[model samples]
Target chain A: MSSLVALLHATRIELLRTLRDGSTLLMMGFPVLLYPAMIWGLTQAGLYIDEARDRETLVLGVADGVDTEGLGDDKVQIVPATLETLDAGDVDALLAGAGDGLELHYRAGSPRSRRTRRVVEDRIEARNTERVDAAAVEKGADAALLAPLEVDVDAIDDATPLVQFLIGLFACAFVPMSIIVSTYSPVVELFVAERERGSIETTLCAPIPRSRIVYARVLAAALLGSLAALGNLGALWITVLHGAVLVVEDPVSLPFPGPVVLGTILALVLSAALLVAVLMSVALSAARTHREGQTLANFVLLPLIVPSMAGMLAVISESSRDVLFVPIAHTGTLLYAAIRHELVATDLFVAVGLDLALAALVLGGWMATLGPTSLIEGIQRPAWLARLAGES
Target chain B: MIEVDALVKVYPGHPPVRAVDGVSFEARRGEVFGLLGANGAGKTTTLRMLVTLLSPDGGTARVNGHDVRTAPEAVRGSVGYLSVTTGLYERLTPREMLVSFGRMQQIADPVGRAEQLIARFGIGAFADQRCGRLSTGMKQKVSIARALVHDPPVLILDEPTVGLDVLVAQTFLEFVETAREEGRAVLYSTHIMSEVERLCDRVAIIHEGRIVAATSVAALVAEHGTVEKGFVATVNGA
Candidate 1:
């Protein structure tokens, strides 16, 4: 048989074996199911907190003789009290010793707070202006002269909603990162498990080339990683659609254009490729048992997590262009930019192209290291392996 | 049809261990050639080189007129190798594993070939059962079937019955005889003196990564008074 035909046969067998293993099925399914549920719950919590804070009453402590008559009495309730009375916990029994006065805390660094504060200050200034205008009219002066030139700032383009931005960012970043962690077991199993069971020895000794064997294993891992990413993407899509309906009065539209969806898929493929390359390299270099390979592969989780954490921080800042070149970090940035229709063609191409190049380099090194002598003899410790000589 | 001329394998390290050093031997077609050595006697290393799995640091080796380093693909195409550690996929059935390997070898009608091999090896009863659930003997049988699935001209077995029970070992020895009758060049590596005495047409005793002696089993036994004494004297220089 031809070498190519032999490799194909081996690859098919590997794929079948991976599919049959229940552990691999769980590895693929767990991230898909769990991440979506977690994201939905988080979205719900965020929406609830926003709604509650938006409608909740703000208690205002009024200094004596300071009128607050037309400052929207419904939203901000005035509580008449002296500083001493508040400090001494004498305002109300329920509030006794509960700090000096009404806690005027707002959501820190929230856009909502900035807007609300501006409106409140504007209303106070308008009330002062009315008083000034009345006084000016009473003095027989022109009230029109009191009205200074006013400027209006109008938003020309529709702004992407904060919730949609966050959903897209998390879905792109967190889902893939989580999938990487979840699918790690099977990746290790593909090579490490075979080594542990002595099956790798059989494979190495076969009439197939060592390079072909390594290729087959890497291909299987990459395919599995892609499947896992797809499953997670599907779950996130479903959850986002349902959660959007529940939270928004108007149908909350995802800003995901055709480019966004395609970019996300491409980003996922690149990430999966990188992950497979790194994992296969580690697996090939492993000199001990399958358990050792598994232990080493867990280090991959650190790289995956870095992007997710960075994405969470990026959601607050909207966009940080510098992060676009940081491996998986770029994936999150690209997905966010794509969803908002803000991605430049050059940036998108660079991110995808660089990621593919990195994967290729890693895979190249792994292939070079996978000659038959190393793969077969590499697994056994030389001291112990040399003892095989002693036994002979 | 296998030839080895002063092959050497040097591993670079603190001490720079020599795994296979100055190993030389030849095996003719249709012969059950035994390679007897203690553990780590470079038996597996030699076999790996012949199968084109490893590169020899020095000298030359050929299998069926194909140089291991230059024509590895051709060498692989013509050689069947079975190591002591059976590498069968646990999730696959015996039939599935065989067919997969047969296809890998680019055999025509791999499934049909796998079925015939299964029947010949008397493994038809559990052909459909997953290999993970098979007994040691059964797994070994599946492995042997996979090795022969491509029906190559050369066969190399590295301690094929190292861990098998007496009955299973006997069955394996019988299979070796069958392989020889089919006119294939066979190289069987083992440390077990009894297996060598029972199955080998001619034997090369290897020690410290080199072949110390080579002769027919009966001639060595007669010359040394017994096969065990001959092997000890050959290995230890007694």
Candidate 2:
């Protein structure tokens, strides 16, 4: 009971320090402000380019003996010309040939030339349909029978491909990356900065065991990581998806993930934060200063990002439970599935269980090295680490 | 009270160095004991062993009747350790710092004890101010108060006045004297001859990793004409 109380007191102190740190606040605020500003800027740029494309008029050249009764529009200027004028850049596009072999020619590099080609092709297609209908009626055949078949392919009930990709990327990559960024600064401040300022020696002299100190510090960092992940997730859902709906006018259905999916997402985020906190706490314990700690953490955490990137590209089937064995990749895959509302209960269990297990294993081993000797004289390189450097 | 018997600490390297070798001393309640040494003389190492911060490789140390190796937590709880390198939390206020350390020590009433120390140490004026914003003298006072918050019976101070101005250093010496008068065993470590002459009841002059002279300050001064001369002769003779 006394140890519990001591742990609580220690945690409170760590939390107070973490909350007052300016770098932590900035890292937490990154997603909230960056997403909105980025989306707004992108939206404005897209709208401006589209409006400019719509306002500009393009010159279209009609070759001799081609149908030209109805082709001009407010944005297209019809002109009589030969292949010479088309090649000389006098016209944006050339509508040449006739009958079943109509040819539309344009400069591929010019934006206005491409636009003009599309407009001329559309007009000619409409005219051809009319003429075909008229000819069919005169030949005593049904005009309706001449209509071309149309097919519409829908991947989901209503969600577009762009929306699905955005949601998948945000879940599999952004949230996890935010959690990592959030967990980093606090670990450095708590472990390396304290050592640099000489406060760690004083804290080590307390009656409490070093394991309790490690636990308190890890808990504080994990809490910050989880909160930052949630903030970034919420900000992403609001700024990007909702903004897409309002601007794109595509009947975009905002994904209201079911309760199960929501719960799984929360679990994945918390477990991931816990894992990162434990990993960083142990890795940074060897560092003597903040700068060194940060550099070391960057190298240690680089491998975790690969799983998230792979999850973005991988299409895991519902029956493929083998993917759950991979540590962080499992979380990323589950996150992608959960965002798409296809997550299975068994997979969620496997992912979170694996994460917690890894965290426990690291914590157990880290506790053994927390003696005063290690704290004061610095931790010696383990045999495996030495062998990894070819020192053995 | 503190008792150290044949304390030994060795650093394993290309060549092993026995930083503290067969050093022995006893500091009873109501007296101040000084460990006088130069750089690399193992003064800090011995103090760290007493406070349970480092384990003696081949010796036994007892603080307030608790053996360091057998009951390190108890020994740690019974001693208040302060050093020049000991630092306070910069983001925490003096009052918060006191309460935090008090709770870590498992004091019965941390808040109340923190208040008492603040008032006793004259830290009430800046109890609410952050440690980073305070002057160096104020920070040292807060550090002293933090060390004593647990009311430990033994106080281990290792070069606690290395960087302080004369006035602040004098104030620290006065606190050491107060701790002695209050029936606490004070283990002061430094190389300053004046501090040893004025504050120490018994002095141990250490050379390399062993004690060369252990006697009362008055006796050493009488024999060598001054504490400085006594320290030099004792160190050279060793």
**Candidate 2 per-residue lDDT over residues A246-281, each given as its tens digit:** 334345667566787778888998898889888887
- What value of lDDT does candidate 1 attain over all alpha carbons? 0.67
Worst-scoring 10-residue span by lDDT in model 2 chain A: A101-110
| Runs in model 2 lying further than 4 Å from the true structure | A58-165, A246-262, A315-322, A369-377, A381-392
Summed over model 2, clashes come to: 0
lDDT of 1 by residue, A101-136 (tens): 222211111224323333333542344345434544
Docking class of 2: medium
Off by over 4 Å in 1: A1-10, A36-163, A250-260, A340-342, A365-392
Task: Spell out the clash pairs found in candidate 2.
Answer: none
- TM for candidate 1 is 0.75
Alpha-carbon lDDT, every model: 0.67, 0.75
**Residue A219 deviation, candidate 2, in Å?**
1.9
